[model samples]
Target: MQLTKGVEQAICIIVLLSTQDNHNPLASDTISEHLQVSPSYLKKIMRKLVVQNIIRSVPGNNGGFSLAKSPEQITLLEVVESMEGEISIYPDTGLINKVFRDGVHTSKGEAVLHDVFNGANSLLRDYLAKQTAADLLKRTMEQSEIPVLNWNITNPSNQNKKE
Candidate 1:
């Protein structure tokens, strides 16, 4: 089963929020600007995250978005589920039963397929659940190729502008 682009953005948003200093909230505009994504589209994803309690929104002028829970507390699976809903790798459409008339063979085939798909789904979910946003952030930080960023700075574009 493939995940949507929203899921990828949601995870990145979490990683961005995790970089906030002094527990300060980062504005959606800032986040969108940094990621080079549309603010409107990011809002939709952020709304889902807020509803799932993955992130929180502030209402004042100095308002923005922040993590509702700690990075260590947020799981990759939680973010995935928040964006895409529950994961169901196999769609039980009953097409196999419809095409195959032999009950014994049909039942055996269905059982085997179900077992394999279920196992795969469970493995994926378990792996995701075990990996937290902090874990991902740490791994990312360990990579020399990726630049470590400070979300608290007045740096939405990650560029040096001439004054």
Candidate 2:
């Protein structure tokens, strides 16, 4: 069960927001550059996040984006859902149909396999849903020995001038 690019980008955006100074909002262009993604694509993802209330946009001259709530309140599952709907690792239709149709297994064997796969899927979703963005952030901070650099300006010209 692999996560899509949209889902990965959403998580990265959330982590970036969590590391912000809190006083200043993050510009989408800046996030795009940092993540090495296209501005248009990132903007679309950002719109979904805004709609989900996962992040809020500030308009006009000092316009940018910020998390709608604290990191503790957000979950990775929520971020994923905001971008990709829901986390469906397994297809809804029973695997039994495939196995039985293919003659790979008997009907009875297929039924048992279906039950096992369904249970695993349920457990996976429950575990993922239970984890909050705050939990991930905490783990990251604890594990990292190196300090992260802060970029206050969005434009490279401004970033260069600062240096």
Candidate 3:
């Protein structure tokens, strides 16, 4: 139920990069400054993102970090997995077996619990996957005082809504 701060920062970073001029890279310091995090700390989070290919590092004077793929291509779950790894809700399979003295009834109860937890986890995964980074980008643009031209032009789903 809880998301790591690193995951939050990573998503924020992605949103910032998406709004940048021409999707050009932004250095870590600039990103950190925007997010109000220390450059050094952001650097570590950025490293994981880059390694996972959520974002790419550019090599040049102006290079910093940029999304490896378009916002439409990146998912919140992917970003989270990159930063924090896979999450397990009710990961302990043997807990029910150890705790309950009644055998089959306890086993049935455990099965039900597993089904509920697993179902919830799958739903969560689906929700995150459907929430692309591009979605966040659009939301961010909407909230920003600066106006963006042709913002929804590239997103087909948004385009449909506009028409």
Candidate 4:
């Protein structure tokens, strides 16, 4: 399963917001500069995030964007879903049907394959939902060695635990 660049960028944007020192919103232009993403594209992604209440936009001269809640409250799955709609690891039904019709596998075989795919997808989503943005931020802060200016606390360990 491949994660789109839009989804990747959305995650990055959320992480960046989580790391900010000030409660004041961050302008799209500033975010664009920091992440080296196009302002127009970032704005489109930001709009989706705002609509989902994952982030909120403040209006006015000093306004920008800020998280609606703490990073711990946001899950990676939520950020990904906000930008990508849904997580679909398996190919669409049309493709699957075509493959089966093309005699790539017997009907029984196809049924087994579908069951396996569904099980795998469910497992992946459950795993993803367990990891929150706060967990990601913690790992980032620990590995970078650069002092976290936004939050005073440090992660328990600098090394990431393997799956």
Q: Which candidate ranks first by lDDT, i.e. highest? A: 1
Off by over 4 Å in 2: 92-118, 143-150, 153-163
Alpha-carbon deviation at 92 in model 4, angstroms = 3.3
Steric collisions counted per model = 0, 0, 1, 0
lDDT of 2 by residue, 1-163 (tens): 6777998889988887776655688888888888999999999999999999989998877678888998778877788778777655556466556656756566677667667778886777677788877778768667432222354555533332211
lDDT of each: 0.83, 0.75, 0.75, 0.75
Better of 1 and 4 by lDDT: 1
Worst 10 residues of 2 by lDDT: 154-163
Better of 2 and 4 by TM-score: 4
Q: What is the TM-score of each candidate against the true structure?
A: 0.83, 0.73, 0.76, 0.77
Clashing pairs in 1: none
Candidate 4, 1-163: lDDT as tens digits: 6778988899988876776644667788878877788999999999999999988998999788888888888887788888777777767465556656756565666678778888887887788889888887778666533222332224323423321
Q: Arrange candidates by TM-score, highest first: which order? A: 1, 4, 3, 2
* Highest TM-score scorer: 1
